[model samples]
Target: MTQDEKGQLKALLRDEPSMRLHRELEKELRDDMMQRLLTVRPDDPAFAALTQFHRGCLHGLHELWGRREQFVKQPIQGGNDDK
Candidate 1:
């Protein structure tokens, strides 16, 4: 994670309004991904890869949504130390 991402995560953890905004963004991204998935033709050469990418995104979103509290309690490991 970049420092900016770490900061954003912290904000999301510490502020209810930040988290609500993050949720709205996530919902928008999910809707866009679903629209893309719907428009893909099964016969297209990229179909499998495209669907797999969206599936991975969906899984990640689900994981994040379910783990917000856990994330709030622990710092994500890959970001540059902000302290």
Candidate 2:
């Protein structure tokens, strides 16, 4: 190849705007893929275990929250308060 053509090719490769565009495209693709994955619901048979596990965890959290609310609403009385 001619030196002029080689210089032009090198300059094109080193262009900052093109490099930034490539990075932006890759980041956009990765974010789009992540959003698609998040949109999918795991109700398939293969995900039954995971679904059940999450459901159980949510139920446990709700139960704990209810208990905490009750405890907060009814403050504990000290044992010596009945004197």
Candidate 3:
């Protein structure tokens, strides 16, 4: 992701309560997806779709949290004030 995008995410996560709520929601979604996956057989028509959706969710969350970690450790850069 671009630095600007990372900065935006950092801004979004800076609110402690919002961040906590986001994490809680992420966990709930993960748990619910896992339960849904349990209902599908490998050969079922919807299994592929469900698994893909699950993978996408995991990948997205991974990216988001990874960026969050980075921003937490590093200071955000100031935008171009001289422009």
lDDT of 3 by residue, 1-83 (tens): 79998787777777788678778968887898889979999899898998788788878876876677666657777877666
lDDT of 2: 0.60
Candidate 1 lDDT tens digits, 1-83:
79998887777666888567767877877787778868878898677887788778778877876788676767568766666
Query: What would the TM-scores of all predictions be?
Result: 0.51, 0.46, 0.48
Tell me the spans in candidate 3 whose CA falls farther than 4 Å from its real position: 1-12, 57-83
Identify the leading candidate in terms of lDDT. Answer: 3
- Per-prediction tally of clashes: 0, 0, 0
Whose TM-score is greatest here?
A: 1
Model 3, C-alpha of 81: deviation from truth (Å): 30
**C-alpha displacement of 66 in model 2, angstroms?**
58
Root-mean-square deviation of candidate 3: 8.2
* lDDT values, one for every candidate: 0.76, 0.60, 0.79
Q: Rank the candidate models, highest TM-score first.
A: 1, 3, 2
Tell me model 1's lDDT, rounded to 2 decimals.
Answer: 0.76
